[model samples]
Target chain A: MTMKRLINLKRTEARRIFITYSAVVIAYVIFQVMSSSGFLSSSMRGMLVPICAYMVMAVSLNLVVGISGELSLGHAGFMSIGAFSGVASAILMQSTITNAPVRLALAMIVGAIFAAIAGFLIGIPVLRLKGDYLAIVTLAFGEIIKSILNNFYFGVDAQGLHFSMLTDTTRLLKGGRLIIRGPMGISGIMKIATFPMGFILVMISLMVVFNLVNSRSGRAFMAIRDDRIAAESIGLDITKYKMMAFVTSAALAGAAGALFAMNYSTIVANKFDFNTSILILVFVVLGGQGNMLGSIIAAAALTVLPEKLRGFSDYRMLLYAIILIVTMLGTNNAEIREFFTKLNPFRRKEEA
Target chain B: MTKRIFTCALLILAMSSCAFGAPFKLGGTAPLTGGAAIYGTAARNGAAIAVEEINAKGGDIQFELRYEDDTHDAEKAVNAYNALKDWGMQLSLGSVTSKPCEATAAENFSDRIFALTPSASSAAVTEGKDNVFQMCFVDPNQGTASAQYIGEKGFAKKVAVIWKNDDVYSKGVYDTFIEAAPKYGLNIVSDTTFADGNDTDFSVQLTDAKDKGAELVFLPMYYQPASLILAQAQAMGYAPKWFGIDGMDGILTMEGFDKSLAEGVMLLTPFNADAKDELTVKFVAKYKEKHGEIPNQFAADGYDCVYAYYQALTQAKANADMSAEELCTKMIEQFTTMTFNGVTGENVKWSANGEVTKDPKGMVIKNGAYVGLD
Candidate 1:
């Protein structure tokens, strides 16, 4: 009887994964068809890659905030790290790696590695803190990263790469190219990110998150989240599980950051600030914590919502705030949640 | 359902009216709601006034001006550009800020759309983008011009430079000023830097310049920090001859600022509101009546951008029916060769590299009003 129940749970999980993958693939196919036929507006077309990047970000952030039940406010810091490192690597390999896709992949790998290292370092001390303290420290770390990037300068020349802080002390030889200028950030970057790459990144992120959530480590993370004392008595390595989730989330955010950074001609450190972390957190919360598919949908919808409201012009942001508030209230309200669950045909069948 | 249908019909009718209009669709982006909204609002007002004046004349160069809000963000600027493109925009005003302009300029170049920016002074906005032209002097140009003006006029032998090192505009001007100073026989005695958070205090920098026996201090930053620096210098009794660039144009009108402190403060600007020229008089009057205040250099630049476009389009014999790609070529040809006279400057010409070649005017504040220095 236990084996039968375990098989049923496995089957349900498989179906959930299948539904998510199919949904993404179907959406991609529809978007391509619409865009190719010129049915999609230029503004919507421009948002495709960014939407994918945001979806990945939301999914990864969900792993930490939803699955692990930890509130992180420094997610954008890892993203910033990834963006700069990815840009630097792409420029460094410009002559060596002529293939665009190969170079982008390598840049994302490098970005993810750098972000993972930062996450591990931060997680060591940060995991010790709980609740609001963790959130505050993460927020401080995000600001610190932004400040450092604001003063950091990097350049490339025939003599290779040079870096400096607080000044342009990287006085290079003739024909030297500045990769990053303090405050001004990096400009004149080759926009190599495409919608297909963004889609692939999102798929990979979802897969990683889903697999981790169903694994023993993911269970340990949830166990710690539910009851720390009980989890500790059960010999679950609390710190190890928490650190694993945090680092993995950071690595995914870094990859998304690389994709986002490469989509634009220029990027600045200020783009990934406290507001951006809050935005990703909002996505996780609104999508219902621990719901990966919901997170993806929420991210894409919210990203497109503002653009769709452009007809309202000046009042668009105000309207967006209103809608967000309403949605939050509706989702948190028990009666509304019960009504929605009753409206779902799948849930009805399960109950029957 | 009937109400929805009626609304849809009204929307279609409105869109059709826009489609049938003979006016050329002109689109641009600005920070209409952010910290830099002042500049964007001024530029939009100036451009609108110019468009109205041109359309009133019923010339072949009628324009339908549309300005979108970018909130001073580069990403939003690109999004705004795409929206404009979808609206069938032919000529572009680019963007009102330097960073956003740089972002949109890349898109304009790749898409073969001609863009003329008003107040985005960074060189990167036009660098390697032949179709992207500017009305205002580039940052390096202002720096070089400032150095030449002070050196040639013999304003001071020993000059000190205090600039915001973290800002691209300030740094660009400072880099060129130092390079050009030695050539003009100006000795830079002291050089100091400040960043965003630490810009409020300037005593250390002022004292350093004073101790170095400097007679003049050059500030290559905006009016906000310059105002604070001026007040701080006065408090410390280190009153040196103050010189600034175009970024200092709004100092006289800054809210709650003591106009007496700005007395005799000289700056190199493209437009002087106190100028007695007929075009300047007319524009200032119109802008003042509409905006309820004195129009700054950015407004003048916006006005000049529209008039320049008028001259180019009229001379090229361009029509409203021309595609953006065709207009792009015509604009490039005309802009590279034509000489334009507008409120900002006379005989304004653009190089193939898209930099404007116009002399900046030297003006000093007297009794809270700008008086021509030369």
Candidate 2:
């Protein structure tokens, strides 16, 4: 009976993976066909990359919030660091690397590396705190990052980088290419993020998150999340696993940031403020914790739904709020959940 | 037999609708229902009125105006651009703010669409774009004009600068002023900054400015914080000659604000609702009659953007039969060579890089209203 139960669990996991992947592949193919045949509207086509980027963000953030059971409010801070570092790298390497794809790939790697280091440094001190303390520290970290980026000005010269703050032009090297200016931010980034590239990044993020969640270390992390004192008594290295999840999450968020930044010509620090962090958090919460596929669906649907409802522009936000409240109530309310379960075709005969 | 006749009738109606000449459609994106709705609603009203007046004159090619609500978001602005493009619109009045304009123009310029923003003042909006244009002075232009005006009038030799630290617009103006002040024989005695939208008590910065014995104080920020600074400074008994740019225009109507705080404040702007000129009087009266309020600089800029487009279209000698691409090319060609006497200013020159060149006039607030300093 135990063997049969283990086999059943494995079968369910396999089935979930199969269903989610097949859906993604089928949707991608249909979108490609429609885009080529001119059946897709321009607005729909424009939404493709952003949707993919947001999906990656949601999935990675879920790893920390849902699986690890720790709330992080600084995801966008890591993203901003990643975006600026990646764009700065691209701008500096433009002379050396003539190929666009190769350049972008290298820049993304650099961004992920920088963002991971930052996460590791911040996680060391922050992991010591619990619950609201962690949340507040992360929030403060995010705001601090924004303020620093706002004052950060950098330009590239033949020698190296020239940096300044508070509009002091005296430090700028002669004839340097100013890449990041304070407040005005980065402008004129080359567009290299296509749908296919974004899809590959999402797949990579999903693989890392899924593998981590299924590993022995992942179980240890979840154990710590369920009962910190109990896990400590059980000799679990809670700090190590928590840092692992956090650094990995930050790295993935960085890659998404690179993709997002490359899609726009001009982007400022204000774009990745506290509101953006809350938006990503909303995606994770509404998607259901520890459900990767649900997060993807939520991100894609929410991003495109507003654009589709542009006809009723005035009531768009109101309708969106109503839909969110209804979905939450339907899923969480006990009576409604029971009523819906009764209508499920997959219910066992005895259970029915 | 009845079904066949119905299908044929439907086909004929569709073909005739396409063949008979449709009105030339122009699109725009505005923050119609968000925090910036005040500016966006005024812009929409101004554009609608311009189209109505133009079509009433009844030219061979009638114009149609359509706008999408972007809510001041960059992504939504791009979506709006794509939607407009799908609707066969090749000309636009705006994607109102700087960030949205940057996002839309970054990718859509290749579609051969002619876009003219009425109030996005950032130089980054149209840096290298060929088809996009701006109808307001860039930050540097206003900065230089402010310095030049103050120097020529000998307003003050010792000036103190206090601006928002984390804002693009405020920083842009402040940076230019810092560089140009010395050139105009003015000394920046005290330079300080505050985080915008966060700080309400600016006693430290104000006290420092007063202690420096500043003859004039420059506030290159919006009216909300500027009003707070004014009230606080008055309470603290520290008064200096306050100068600002167009960002301070809305201070007079600020809810529960002390109107006397702005009584002697001066600013650099292009439009004055109280101007006595014939065109100014006519536009102001018509706008008040229609909208029940005098138009702001943004509304004036919006109205002028439409007239500028029409003037360019006419100067190109574009006919009803011209394709959108041909008409766009003609419009671009005429924009470089001609100057239109617009409602905002006379001889407004549009450069190739999409910067608008017009002399910004100085104004002072008296009895809770803006009046021309000259």
Worst lDDT 10-window in candidate 1 chain A: A1-10
Tell me how large the interface RMSD of candidate 2 is. Answer: 1.4
Error of 2 at B115 (Å): 1.2
Report the CA-based lDDT of candidate 2 relative to the real structure.
Answer: 0.82
Give the CA lDDT, 0 to 100, for residue A66 in model 2: 95
Evaluate candidate 2 and give its CAPRI docking class based on DockQ: medium
lDDT of model 2 at position B263: 84
- lDDT of candidate 2 over A110-182, digit per residue (tens): 8788889989999999999989999999988888888888888889876787788766463655787789887
Give each candidate's interface RMSD in Å: 1.5, 1.4
Highest-scoring model, lDDT: 1
Q: lDDT tens digits, residues B1-374, model 1?
A: 99999999999998666553499888899988866787888888889989989988875678899999888888889888999999999999999988889899999999999999998888889988889999999999999999999999999999999998767778889989999999999999999988766778998999999999999999999899999999999898888899999889878777899999998899999899999999999999998898788888888888888889989998998988899999999999999999999988999999999999998999898998888898
Regions more than 4 Å wrong, model 1: A1-16, B1-21, B157-160, B185-192, B196-215, B230-238, B252-261
DockQ versus reference, model 2: 0.62
- Candidate 1 clash pair list: none
Q: If scored against the real structure, what TM-score would every candidate get?
A: 0.91, 0.93
Native contacts recovered, each model: 0.53, 0.66
**Ten contiguous residues with the weakest lDDT in model 1 chain B:** B15-24
Top of the candidates by TM-score: 2
